[model samples]
Target chain A: MGKQVPVAEGVFTWPSDEPRLIGSKCTDCGNVMFPTQSGCPKCSGQTTETVELGRTGTLWTWTVQGYPPKSPPYAGDASPKTFEPFGVGYVELPGEVKVETRLTVSDPEHIEIGMEMELTFVPLYTNDDGDEVVTFAFAPTAS
Target chain B: MTTDDVAIVGIGMHPFGRHEGVSGMDMGVSAVRTACADAGVEWSDIQFAFGGSAAAGNPDTMVSKLGLTGLQFINVVNGCATGGSALFSAYNSIKSGMFDLGIAIGFDKHERGAFRVNTRSSGLGDWYGESGMALTTQFFGMKINRYMHEYGISNDSLARVSEKAFRNGSKNENAWRRKPLSMDEVKESAMLSYPLTQYMFCSPGEGGVALILARADQAHKYTDTPVYLKSAVVRSRRFGSFEVMAPSVALEHNAGPTVDASAAAFEMAGIGPEDIDVAQLQDTESGAEIMHMAENGFCEHGEQEHMLAMGETEIGGRLPVNTDGGCLANGEPIGASGLRQVYENVLQLRGDAGERQVPNNPKTAYTHVYGAPGISGVTILAK
Candidate 1:
């Protein structure tokens, strides 16, 4: 594998300046799925295409990570002192697509399903060579 | 509480195992063919079809695996509950009066290992671990430890459940794991999850199960005594575990999907615990079956061990559960398990379950099917 970059390439990106997540739309069922996929689960026939989603969405659910997850694919250390309580929640976009991602709020109690939120880029952590690794998260949008 | 009437006229299973030659479509064809033969109906006679599959290798390219040619319906891949999802879809289609007969088919030829939904397409959540955390065995392992901490249930009781299932499975030609296992042997088995021995966790297997749903009038043409679908209820997790209450049966506390779904099914079926003569509960882990019993109202909360010790759930007991040895003995076919449980329940109610058959010959039976990540589907069938 190539050296880890500031941002992982081939992770998917939108064409426009507006921050948005990527997904695949099923032409057969009109259903949309996030993180992009090759096929639809409902019709199992049609192939999927990389479609851009709205930058803003509603919070479908939220939870605070009580403990660090044990697997990789994440870039941070699990030191209790350094690792802050990270919150994860489901953000519902326009179609039926619901994306699960890290939340940008502090207190998890305030988060609830149907709460309006917007996508915001956040620095996940620093890499071995001191490159600032960044990722996308959702934050409550001011009404 | 009464819903639309539905009846199961035919049910068939291709014995579960690791077969190198047959693909998922081949398995589906075998199962569908058997079900048609058993129901004495022609394939063209069916009006609709619902396909359930999970790890379909080259799934996108293989649409005809389920024999869904001209039939119009849905295809669901809901992790472990795939079969239940298909059953629900088929039931709804038949209930709509659009078709006189509906076929629900599920097939999976997975190699022994973990299961994961590629989030890249569905983007619901981050991809779970491959061999470590994402595996259903490890997920149930975590739940098993928590259940032991809360319930103080004994290892012996769990072993007894496994032993009974293995003994029963030995007689089932269609079961994947058919070897007889003793309680001592179960207890001595290697540890896959703490407080749950290897025998306690369900082993992955390959299998296909097919069910034929028809109108009550048409059902008699296929089988003498039809297994009517009194209700098929699915409970979904509206939110994450953070919002869910601590493990308790209190309506306020989150009893998880199992309790909620079972309650809905019971209401729809217009039946209570007293009316149920048999149950085929998902015991992917020992705690699952025991906890589900209380949730499904088979017994009071935290009283499963006592009931088991009293032989209340045995073949001759008040509520004979898993008369066909549940996942504990049958081997977890992942996608095929939901319909497999229904097949067993119907067999018992029809008095066709040879050695493992309940003596009373049940009139009303329930199957509480659950998945690892938190999904429950309950189906109640009446003779």
Candidate 2:
């Protein structure tokens, strides 16, 4: 295996057996935001702290991306010959926030609203540098 | 100042479709000329211009088509709310007595496929885009699925909305998709996203719309039946509202921009949703129309199913909506889409909508447009 690389830096921890999403928590309102924010969007309070979000969440809603999106940002292997649709949705991480995410399942029939899910890393694509580009997604938890 | 101080004296549009070999500027010129002719005013009479476009070039280019009169020509780009924002600007300018006659123009010619994502411009980091969550279609699908589950809205109801849109489009000569679709056909359309079929979504296309506005006192000088601008309000997202293109949402829910803008418009117009005779709400997708009906105070939550079942949203229904086929049939040309809503409302209010005209002469009309990451524009017009 060539080295592993995250699709983007600073969104989550990498190279760990168990990784969690990085976010910001408003010390005043206790509000949490993913991808981190400079300040609280709610109370507009400057006081905030970095925090790790919960790993488990429930499916708020979902859909199958039957069509491959336009390129540049979509660096996946989406050639018409090999393109396969996938499931995407919002996962409610309890009281933290509803994170928009790609689901592991591609079949809409297999997914249900309010289904339990857990955060996990998945290979988005390999870069020209021969490194595995990983991104975050939610998958059905065995529990 | 009161919104009624300004009035729409003229309205026109370049038919919504693929204008092969036609430049966006030419389409805009055509629309502007049509509006000026309809208003019985010469280009020299206009004092100010507000132009909006998305993929098309700067709106100031319109000065080349319509002679530059050394008047203010401001260009606007507010996602899908572009036209509505321009209209708002013109409304304020006229109401402030800064100009007696002003024009708002929206035109666009977009390349095919889903709207290209500009991660930087969208305020989304590279990770959000790389995760494949940036597509607007997925957002609509996900939001509608959650809405259906929470409100017990059925798939058939979703199909019914599309059916009505196409049926209404069939009578609109300017609409891109003019063929009526059966419910089964709509339901069986290719699945773009879960619970949302291909027919449920509106594709981006080429179009242009223009409106001529004047002080209410001077409107009769241009036209005998000027459509009064009762309200023109634009709103941004409030914290916690479910916004398409948002990377994440707050734990607590707040009213979306459509609700906020519509509420403000109703207050300004001095009319409730029930008081409006005809309406045009954003139908970026069929599900949006259903939810917007409730959001705009036209009906109660979970009341859309009953309304659809009773045929209350059809052309002859109690409150005919999207009488010009809406975005579903018009194909959303971003900048022009919002103003297209106003143009359709103006037609209905003037009793000039030929085949798709609402049965009773609609004196009051409501129009709304909602764009990504949370923004909404609403305008109420009266004859």
Clashing pairs in 1: A36-B120, A37-B121
**What's model 2's lDDT at A80?**
66
Q: How close is candidate 2 to the true structure, as a TM-score?
A: 0.98
Q: Give one digit per residue, the lDDT tens place, for model 1 in A1-143.
A: 22323244323362235656666777776667655667765567467777777788776545454333343434454564676555555566755566656677746356655789998766655667766665667889987
**Per-candidate count of clashing residue pairs (backbone under 3 Å):** 2, 0
Candidate 1 chain B worst ten-residue window by lDDT: B242-251
**Native contacts recovered by model 2:** 0.80
| CA shift of B285, model 1, Å | 1.6
lDDT of 2 by residue, A1-143 (tens): 67889888778888778988888999998999987887888999998899989999999889999988887678886686787898987899987999888889988778999999999977889888999998988999986
Model 2 ranges with Cα > 4 A deviation:
B1-4
Candidate 2 lDDT by residue in tens digits, B153-266: 899998999999998999988899999999999989988888899999999999999999999987889888988998999999989999888878887989799999999999
